[model samples]
Target chain A: MDFFHVLVVLLESTIRVSVPLVFAALAGLFTERAGVFDIGLEGKMLGAAFAAGAAAAVTQSVWIGLIAAILISVALSLVHGYASITQRGNQIVSGVAINFIVAGSTVILGEAWFRQGGRTPALAEGARFQTISFPDADMIREVPLLGPIYADLLSGHFLLTYLAFAMVPISWWILYRTRFGLRLRAVGENPGAVDTAGISVIWLRYRAVICCGILCGFAGAYLSLAMTAGFVKGMTAGKGYIALAALIFAKWRPKNVMFACLLFGFLDALAIRLQGTPLPLIGQVPVQFMQALPYILTVILLAGFIGKAIPPKAGGVPYVKER
Target chain B: MSTPYAKLPGWVEYGLIPLINLAVAFLVAGLVVLLVGENPLEAAYHLINGAFGRGEYIGFTLYYATTFIFTGLAVAVAFHAGLFNIGGEGQAYVGGIGVALACLWLDQTMPWYVVFPLAILGSVFFGALWAFLPGWLQAKRGSHIVITTIMFNFIASSLMVYLLTRVLKPLGSMAPQTRTFAEGGQLPKLDWLLSIFGLDVGTAPFNISFLLALVAAFGVWALIWRTRLGYEMRTMGHSPSAARYAGIRESRITVITMMISGGLAGMMALNPIMGEQFRMQLDFVQGAGFVGIAVALMGRSHPGGIIPAAILFGVLYQGGAEIAFEMPSISRDMIVIIQGLVILFAGALENMFRPAIARAFAMRGQRAAAVVQTRGA
Candidate 1:
């Protein structure tokens, strides 16, 4: 393929791989920014993915499934919020429990309800996300040096992919510009201060967690309905954890988190491409290595770089009402 | 029923705590099964029976408990140092591989006297290696053990999967395990003891691993309670700054504790390789390291406490599998639900028990009031 074709493939694939991560990372941002450590993103995404796929298959419209998935995920996130925020339970354990709950529950429910063990019924084409066709600006292709790169790197994706990129700026603007953002950050950094200021720390955390839930919902929707158009077992496949790492690697900055997600996505894309290419000694180079590529990069990026990323001081501490 | 439980004595509270934990554990398992439309009570009944009903099943449970002791102890020691060593999974695998390698390399030429010690030591050596990196990172760079250990798990898993498929692939076969250990490398099984109990020996794979696990637990208890190093580890766990202020090298302790934890857990692999797998085979360490976290947590990270906790875990494991077949109603995932519950209740022990104890004392007052009223009537 020509350079232009390669660029286009890279562009589309990057969106396909990174959208879920971007959404998840952004979800993580809302929680972390509000001072709630959300290791439950993996569980939230898995739960949402199953719910969305099952809903889509039954409803025959991915849109309705997406909405229901968001509602369900938000509800589940509330469980985490209640346990951590109200009960003042251990956030890490609660998060771990949520993950376990979703992982085990999804498969059990799937097997019984659909009679398909660990998977949902496949979606109809109508239930699947369709690509949006944009008119080729061939004139741009004929223009100066930057034209081909632009065409190759910027066209043809599901609407959500475009929205994934859009959410970062939206998150950034909301976090830095709005009243809600200020309250959220304040609650995270100092619940006592937020409380003394007459704002309910509980409400602020709940709001942040709910926002996180919606993004995670969309991330799950993207994996099952948008990217592949089916729900396989564990299809989210630790993307939520990567998103958590991305959030940390970005050090609570939305744009940087987006960049981190894209970097991991790039390595993922690179590994997938290398699969078809011939290499010496180890023929085909076991797909397991490629499958593990993003996680390995996540590990390195997190261990190496996140050493410098500072979390909100009160991040994992549950806020309790004490006079 | 008016809060069913009221105030209680301190010892009663302590004894009833495990009961509450057991109840909660089954409830969690049952609830999960119920979600799939299975009867919770029936599922649990089968699970309970399956885990402890037979000599063979009990043997399997003991077999599991033996390894769990290692991983549990590994996690417990690290917990003492305030380290979350998720790398137990990785360390155990490497250690298992070490045993496999030693057995494979020395199987034909070496006698049992030399080969067995070398193989076990080899496992410990690799286990330490597995933990060293994360320990080093935490000590030197102040990296969170939780995150770094998680990273190592992924790396170890990837490496192991590759080894099974490529480098460690068995001869003349596509089987995912190494060739069987030589007779010299195998641990001696006490089949005669099972026959004494009127049980078929082969049914219960239980062997000498239990003794070693017991010795290790006592060793851990002594290490934690009796020694200056133990005091330092506890101090470090409670307050790293305080330990440092006391002239203790906090970083060195962190590394040493993790190394010891990982090495002991590595020793647990000897049970399966020398006793059961015979072949250093595929993915045998199924979540033992992770489950070790549950065991340690439930045991409250106490050495004596861990044995009972490990046995409880083993019973549930064996029982959960039996439930899968015998009951056919309970889903096999009952084990995870039970595990999750054990962790939950163990974590909540103080809060749960404190209230119950206070309420019990209040009940005594109510009984006295009732007697006075009856006498007046």
Candidate 2:
């Protein structure tokens, strides 16, 4: 392959791999922007993945699978909302509980329903999301520099990939421009102020959480239906946590979230490509180091060595109304 | 929800409330079992029987409990300082390195007893070292302990995998683990302890580490309840501003409490490495650190409560395994479901029933006072 071809392949893989992270990071952004510490993002994604995979396999309809994913994820989001918002419970503990519950129940339910040892059956073509091709891609392929970039890098991708990228501007607009966006941000930073303004802090927080769930559901469906053939046990493999790291690394801004996820996704793609390949001075890079790079960088970012990551002021604290 | 009312008795506050939370958790777990088309009561019977049926079962249950106790104490210690050290898994992972290094260096020359103390020192040192960074970051750099510790866990997992596969694996072995330890490294099984009760120890890995865990629990209890440092930690936990006013060094106490918690989590390596596996392997911590969170929540962060909570989890784990074998439909993940519920009810939603309970007690107190007034009149 030529240099251009290899570059296109790498960039293509980067976009594909980062799609899930983008969705999840956006999901986390919505919740944290509303002052809810949602470590349960992983669980919601996992449960949705299982639900989507199972539904798709049984019904052979990708749309139905997507709907199932959304429903299950929304249900989990509400559980988190009820615990942290309505009950005024410890948000971190509730998030942790939700994570553990979904992690375990997904496998248990998968085994009971499928009998495939905690995996859904492989999805058929009708049940899986296929890549969409842009117009006139074949005729443009022979053209030199831009053809491969257009055809290979950007033109062909699952519909979700475009949507994931599209969500960046959409979320930016929603967070900064909309009325709900202002109140959500206000509630996170100062629920008391929001309350004094005659707004329901609890209801605003729940709406943000539900938005987070919807995004997470899309991320999960992308994982099981588009990225892979079917759901495998622990397939997310800490992607949820990485998205969280990306959120913190981006300082919880919508536009920065896209870049952070892409950066992590690029590193992942490069890691897979670089495995066992000898390099100058470094000899051969260990895959473990590459896998750990995102987390290590996130830690450094969190430590304020790179930049200070100031979370929403009211993050992790339950908002109690004073009589 | 915060109503100033009559103070609750010790039994109601410490005992009845926790039991109710636990019962509710189990009830939810039972509903999950029913959802899977299995009889919840039947599953419970199998679980209970599997944990306590045979002498071997009891041995295994205690063996699992031993690990939980160590990790649980680790969480409790940090919790008392108002720090949530979620890096127990990473600390314990690196602590295994400490145990492995000591065993590898002197297992052939030194006896088991000599190696044991050195191993303990090594585990504590490395484990504390692993936690010290996050603690330091939190204290000095104003980072969140939960986020930093979680990052450390992934880092620890990566570091251990690299060490085991490329650095520590024997010359010919393909597995990513060190070779089995010599006689000096292996801990002796406590067969005599079980034999005293006329129960055979069987093939269970119950060993002297059980005693070590018990001793550590006692030490933690004394440290948190008796020592001046313990008093400072509690004060810091309750209100950092108050602690600062009392001339307590917040940064110093935060660092010290984290190290102590990390040291206790590091000690958990003894049960799996020295007592059972006899060598370090990849991912040997195996979610035990997360289990500690649930145990601490259930135990209410008291060493007294942690012991029973640890054993109860041990029962769930052993029994869950039994159920997995007996009924293939219900996997071992059932225990994880139960664990999450326990943490949810006992920790996050702890006040779910408290308001009602408090209101009931307040009404009773008023009624008794009215009765006394009527009698006097």
Candidate 3:
């Protein structure tokens, strides 16, 4: 392949790998911006992936699988809301508990239903997501830079990838421009002020968490239905945590979240690409070090060795109104 | 505004509540078992029998408990200072490196007693150093402890993989583990100690490290309750601003608390490395560090409470393995579900039933008050 082709392939893979991270990071943004710390994003995504894969395999419909995934994700989010908000339990502990519960439940239920080593049976062609190509791609291919960009880089991606990128600007507008978004942001920073303005902090927080669940649902669905044929054990891996790190690295802004996810995705794709290739100075860089780069970078970012990251003021604290 | 359950006697608060929570968790686990087409009671019986039916089983259970106790205390100590140290897995992993180094350098020349103390010191030093950075960041840089510690776990695993494969793996061996320690470097099993009491443990992995765990627990109890440093740490946890006003150095306490916590977690290497395997390997820490979180939460961050909590989990681990072996339907992953259920009930939904119980007690109190009023009238 030519250098241009290589660049196009690398960029395409980066976008493909980053789709889930983008969804998950945006999911985290909604919750954290509304004053709830969501360490359980990993668990919710895992649950949705399993539900989506199992449903699609059975129903032979990707739409049905997407709906099943969202429903399960929302259900898990409600459990977290009830525990952390209504019960006044520790939010971190609740998130951690959710992670454990969902991680175990998915495997157990998957094993019971499928009897396939905690994995859903692979979906057939009609049941899985098909790539969407831009119209008249063959005719457009001779048009130089725009042609290659359209036909090679942008075309033929799973529908979820476009949706994930679209959600970035949509999320930014909602978080920055909309009235509900204003209240969500205010509640995260100072719930007492929002309550004084007659807004119900609990309701606002719940709405944000539900939004988070929906985004995580899409993220999980994308993983199982579009990126892969079916759900595997721990398929989300540490992406949820990585998305969380990206969320913090973005300083909890919607646009920055996209950039952060793309950066991580690029790192991931580069790690895979460079696995066997020898470099100039370092010779052949070990794959483990490359895989660990994101986490190490996240730690350094968090430690303020680079830029400062300030969390929402009321993030971990459950608001209790005075009588 | 005081709830009746909150006004319960001390024993009920500390003992009965946890017991009830454990019962609820097990009930949920049983429901899950039933859903999987197995008899819950039969599975429970097998679990209990496998965990404690024979002296050998008991020994293995205690051996598992020893590691849990160390990790649990590690979590509890940091928790008392209002810090969440989730990097125990990483700390323990690096601690293994320390043990390996000590054994590698001293095993051939030095006696076991001399080598063991050096290894213990090495483990403690490395573990403490691993935790110190995160604690320092949380104290000075305002970084979240949970995020940094979790990040460290991944780093620790990757670092170990790199070290084992590239640096530490013995030449000409394909296995990803170090050379076995010399006979002098290995810890003696506790068989002789048990035999003195006319009890046989049947060549279990139980070793003198279990005694070390007990001693560490007692030491933690004393540190948290009987010392001024512990007092300062508790004050800092309860109210950071108040602690600052009271002349406690927040950063100092944070660092010290994490160091002690990491040291405790590091000592877990003694059981798995020196006592059992006699060689360092990758992923040796397994999920024990995460399980320590559940243990500390269940134990309410007290060394006294952690012991029993650790033992309970030991039963789950040993018993769960037994059940997996006997039952074809229930896989090893089911044990994880059970563990998750316990964590959910004990940690997250700890007070779900508290208000109802309090209301029930309040009604009884009101009725007695009305009877007294009527009798007097």
Candidate 4:
């Protein structure tokens, strides 16, 4: 295959892989920007993924399941926020508990509902997200080097993939150019300033967390409805944590978050491609190498070794009224 | 107003917090059982009695308790250093695999005493190595311990599954498990001692590993409160800046703390090995490392406090497994529902003072006198 054609396969796979992480990272960005520690994003994603898959399988409608997923995940988020924000509970414990709760509960619920023990009933065609194809694929394919990649990679993705990409700009707009953005960033960096400015800090944060829930809803849907079309126990895997890393890597900026997600997605794409492939002198690729790639990059990024990526100063610390 | 509540000692202040936390967890567990349509009080009773009830039950629990003790202390040690180490699940598994390999391959001909300790040491080496990666990342690379540790858990689980199924499958059988430990590799039962006590201990599933656990706990306590390295850890936990200024090498302490923590978790793998079982099956450590997180939390990150917390969990685990027999469809997973809720409630301080905090917040910070009880990390 030509370089352009090779690039196309890379691009297409990258986008599909990046979508869930993008939604998750954006979700993380909102929560962190509102000053709530959200190590629970993994749990939220898992809960949402299970709900979306199960609902879609039952209703045979992806859209309904998507909505249900958002609601269910937001409920978990409420639990996390209520603990960390309201009660000033330890963020890490609450997060781990949520993850554990979702993990064990999902399996128990699945066992009760489907007799499958650890998985939901697989969804039929109407319940799964359909891949979209360009109307003028032939024309687009002939345009240029970039065009070929775009035709192959950008085409035939789920609608949510497009929306996930669109979210980068949307998140940037909502977090930078709007009133909520001002309060959101202020609350994260300086909650006292926002509080003194007459804005309700808690309410403003509550909205951001809600928005995060909705975005994560899409990620969960993308995983089950589009990525695999079924729910497997612990299937969201550690993608949510990767998304949190992406958020940190991007310095909590939406556009930058896109770059980080794509980088991780590329590694994921490469990993998949390398699976079962024999290296020239090195022999079969050790799967562990690929598995550790994203985490390796995360450590590098978080170390500020890849330039300075400072978190919002007050990111995980709860704010209270100070005299 | 003139009560000791106005001036409790530091250790008691922190120590009693976990006890209260356990009570809070029990209350929440009761509520969860209610949701499951069972009698909360009755279930709680069964939970406690089942754990310590019959000689058989205590036999089972004692067999299981060592792992929770090790893993709980593992997490608590890291917690003392202000690091939320969720890598226990992975570390314990890695350690178990190491113990299995050492007995199954290398130390098969060694004397029982040498082979047993050697297997445990093998576990520590691997567990420490596994934890070393995340610890290094957190210390040198600025990665959040929570995130890195979590990612390692996935990597560990998948890698273990693949290895067990592929590289390490038993030769004769296609089972994804190691052959039993060789004769000399297994620990000898303390049957004489059990009979001498007249406790009527059956087959002696309980081993000297329990004594090792108690020793490790007190050992950890002394390390943290009475030693130089521990002083650095506590200082760093309270304030990294002060620790650094006080001539403690913060980065080195981070790595060393993780190594010790992971080594402790490695001891969890030792339970199955040195026990009557004498070999670890896949995830034989099971989710003990994860549940140990709750134990570490409810124990309020104290070495000694983790014992009762782990005992409570062991009872619930043993009892919850029995529920599958009576209500076949309900299955053993219902215990998870209770466990998850206990972790949540035990870790949630707001739940402890819910009514008071609710009233205080309702008044819009009016009743918030001083408000200085920041949550533990």
Candidate 5:
């Protein structure tokens, strides 16, 4: 293939790989912005992926699978809310617990139900998400750059990819312009002030967590129903943690979160592409180094080599009134 | 959160609360077993029998407990200083490199006693060095410890994988492990020790590392409770501002505490590397490091409490394997679920039932007061 064709392929793969990270980072954005540390994002995504894959395998409908995934993700999110918010428990401990519970239960249930060594069966065509083609794309195939760009780079992606990219600006708008967004931000920074203004901190925090769950549900479904054809044990594979790093690197802003996720996704895609390919001076970049780049960069960024990443002021502190 | 059990008697606070929480966790786990068409009581019997019924089983259980004790103490030391060092797995992995190097270099020349101490020192040094950067970042640059430490774990795993496959594996070997250590570098098994008591225990992997774990526990207790540095670390944990006001350098304390924690975690490599495996291998630390978090929480960050908690988890692991072997219906993942339940109840929802217990005590006190008042009138 030509250089332009290679570039197009790379960009396409970048978008494809980034879709899940975008969804998960956006999910973390909602909750952390509302002052709830969400280390359990991995667990919720894993649970939803299992539910979606199993349900889709059985029902032969991706839409129904999506719904099941959302319900399960929301249930886990509510459990986190109950533990960290209502009970005033240690938020980190609760998040860690949620991760362990989901990680264990999904495997047990998956094995017991399917007897497939903790995996759902390969999904049927009707059950899997199909790539969406742009209208009349074949007609313009002979046209120069625009045709390939439209056909290869943009078109024929899973529908969730489009939704994931779209949610970025929508999230930005909601977090900046909406009244509920203002209240959510305020509660995270200073809950006492919000309570004095007569808004219930508990309800507002719950709403943010629910939004987190919905986004995580979409991420999980996209993993099982769109990106792959089945569920595997630990398929999320620390994507949740990477999303967390992205959230911190973005300084917990919606637009920055999208950028950070995409950047990390591009790095991941590059890592996959560069494997076994010899370079000029480096000879060949080891696969392990490429895989570890994001985490190492996260550590560097967190150490204030770039800029300070200040979390929400009241993050991880369970708010109590009249205390 | 201030423990709500502060007003309760010591036995109730330390002993009864954890027992109740453990009971509830097992009850829920039993329900899960029942859902899978198995008898919960029968499963319990199998678990107990598998963990402690035979001398060999008990040896394996304690062998597992030895590793847990090291990691648990690692976590507890950090927790005491307001740092959550979740990078024990990584530290232990890097520590294996230290043990391998020491064994590879000195085992041919040095005696066993000399080689053992040198290897222990090497492990502690490497583990502390791995933790030093994150601790420095948290102290000097105001980075969050939890995220940095977690990031370190992924990095360490990648590094270890690279080292094992490319650098350490001997020529023509298909496996990703170092060559076997020289005989002088290996630890003696505990079977001989048990035989001295006139009892024959089967050949188990239990080894001298268990005794090292006990020594480490005593060391941690003395360091935390008796030393001035330990007192300062606790003060910083309670209030950084207050610590600063009282002339304690929070940054120094942060670095020192994490190093010590990392040193303890590094010691966990001894059990699998020196005692049992006799060579460096991938993932020998397994998930014991994460389990240490649950152990530390259940132990209330005390050395005394951590020993028993570690043993309990060791039982679950050994017993769970037995259950998975005996019953095809129940997978080994059930043990993970049970571990998760215990972590949830003992750590996150620790005080969920505390209020009820406290209220009961309060009501009893009020009734006694009213009776005394009536008699006085």
Candidate 6:
């Protein structure tokens, strides 16, 4: 009812919506950093969402759903890897093909399996990721601002939400601190250099895509198992693209990716909130304009209207060893 | 991977290669059909029979091909210039706005003949405008065309939703679409043309747009194979560095090529909006732009090849609809799977079979050379 509460509520929704973007953008970070352009993130996520939803519905276990999602997503990532990394093919074209494949197959398979018009059955509570409540939330409720912020805004989120946030620092540490991170970034920038230094560019890129697939699996599982009750056809919508935009907007940095996703998520929440509300002076604000803002802003950012977004130096080019 | 292989004969290079790729794609799709518990042979029979069993069915297939031709040419033109114009979908969607505006303004007073030219211009203008930013950004600002064009697609979708629901929707109508066009706005169907072959089209929306698409394909062929601009585009496509060395303006060529591609993509709306739907609707493009990529890839980015490739997709689409009716388990998405496979094999893994083909040719050539040496001895 109060201003702070309304703000907290909006922020809470923002966090919820940004979870998938966070996971997806981080997934993209690994692949792109390792010199593999993955426009198929959307397809991978959608495939995993269907897999997770179907598995969860069948087994009534969220953990099984997560595992299934991972397996399916990883399979897709391998296809992309084989095409771009192994075949020396066009990365963009391969990614596009993957996207179209998953987009259609998920629906076809879902229909054949469930007969619910390309949707998995609605999942029971046990099949979905459960929300975890902070300890002593009832006792702490009387403490006014801090209590509401901690208990209401921060606590009572799906387990994946916490994991998604935790992934930020973990990803940052892996990207900047670890040995694998160094080789990964090095491969993206100069695969030839990495090759010269006795590192297998092909193997490193494969591992990065594997990492990408694992993270995308989490993102997809979170969508069907945590955010929604079941898998719906085309449910990821353009989140994968939005995640790509967020990655570019963030300049491919892990910390910036989180902020960019949260910002986009906030905009999405605002659009939903302002759907029918008339604003002062401007009168009715079309929700479409708000919805389009992220894409439009991304285009602008891509055009270097703001700061330039430079991808990895060797990104999108398939590496070939000199014979 | 960059090493050049033996040069292939013309037939093998163009015809046999694409055919093999198509066959492989279908084989994979057939396997998927088998996985779905339907006999693959039965599905294929139904698919073929559905596509060509009746004159009306052929009309429907060609009608679908009309849209593909325009989009395919769009992609082919861009391909000739080494630019991947993924904004075709967005361009086509926005292009409908031009056609709608022209129809809404002049359909009451003008004849279809008068409005048609103006609509073409308007569609091309709007579609080119949608692609121009991405093109210009790629040219001058070092932005990736793929990413920018993709972003434009989302923007166009959102923009159309707003325009249809808020601005274009007829008063009190629940649907998000414009008012139906008047007779002056509608394209005349090729009923008489079909009757010449003693085949009745039977409710098929095949119209003048099919002819227009054919003309556009011819135009693309001439432009790509004959004209000076086409030469520049092909040169740039093959080697940008060489093009730059040869004094071709890289930025100008990129922008112009994208505009031309966008214009061609935009013209695809004429088939659906004027020939079929008779009005602008949200999502009217309906993946045609994306299909253009497959068509271009399958056709090897030649207008001559694109026509047949476009018609093949037309078969898949029309026949897939029939399969959906005949076998409820095998949905239209099966056709989409075929499409994806075609793109994967024809576009991304295009050279998957090339090495083997090249080796076969190399061995045959070596044998011929040995025979010549033996004859000389």
Clashing pairs in 5: none
Supply the DockQ value of model 6: 0.79
TM-score of chain B of 3: 0.95
Candidate 1 off by > 4 Å: A1-4, A136-153, A276-307, A320-323, B1-14, B111-113, B170-173, B193-196, B327-330, B348-377
Q: What is each predicted model's overall lDDT from 0 to 1? A: 0.78, 0.93, 0.88, 0.78, 0.89, 0.92
| TM-scores of chain A across candidates | 0.89, 0.98, 0.97, 0.94, 0.97, 0.98
Model 3 residue runs over 4 Å out of place are A138-147, B1-5, B193-199, B368-377
The superposed Cα distance between candidate 4 and the true structure at residue A159, in angstroms, equals: 2.1
Model 1 Cα lDDT, one tens digit per residue, B1-377 = 01234556656555667667667766766667777787877776776688767778768888888889999999999989878786788888878888888888887888766777887788889998889878887787666677677667767777887788778877677777787777767777766666688865555668776787888899999999999999999999988888989999988998899889889878888888877877777678887887887788777799777888899888877877887787543455556656656665665232455565567668888999999999999
Query: What docking grade applies to model 5?
Result: medium
Candidate 5 regions off by >4 Å? B2-6, B196-199
Name the TM-score of candidate 1: 0.89
- Backbone clash count for every predicted candidate, in the order shown: 9, 0, 0, 3, 0, 0
Candidate 5, residue A149: the lDDT equals 89
Tell me the deviation in Å of residue B223 in model 4.
2.2
Residue pairs in steric clash, candidate 1?
B6-B359, B6-B360, B7-B358, B7-B359, B7-B360, B7-B361, B8-B357, B8-B360, B51-B319
Model 6 — TM-score against the truth?
0.98
Residue lDDT tens for model 2, B1-377: 24344579999988999999999999999999998999999899999999999889999999999999999999999999999988999999999999999999999998999999999999999999999999999999999999999999999999999999999899999999999999999999998998999998899999998999999999999999999999999999998999999999999999999999999999999889999999899999999999999999899899999999999999998988999889888989999899999989998888889889999998999999999999999
Q: Comparing chain B with the reference, what is the TM-score for each candidate? A: 0.88, 0.98, 0.95, 0.85, 0.96, 0.97
lDDT string for model 5 (B117-232, tens) is 88889889888988898999999999999899889999999999999999999999989999988887788778876677654557668888899999999999999999999999
Model 2 lDDT per residue over A8-77, tens place: 8888999999999999999999999999999888988998898899999999999999999999999999
For residues A182-210, could you state the per-residue lDDT of candidate 6 as single tens digits?
A: 99999999999999999999999999999
Worst 10 residues of 5 chain A by lDDT: A136-145
Model 6: colliding residue pairs: none
Per-residue error (Å), model 5, residue B320: 1.0
Distance (Å) between predicted and true CA of A66, model 4? 1.7
Per-residue lDDT for A169 in model 4?
A: 95
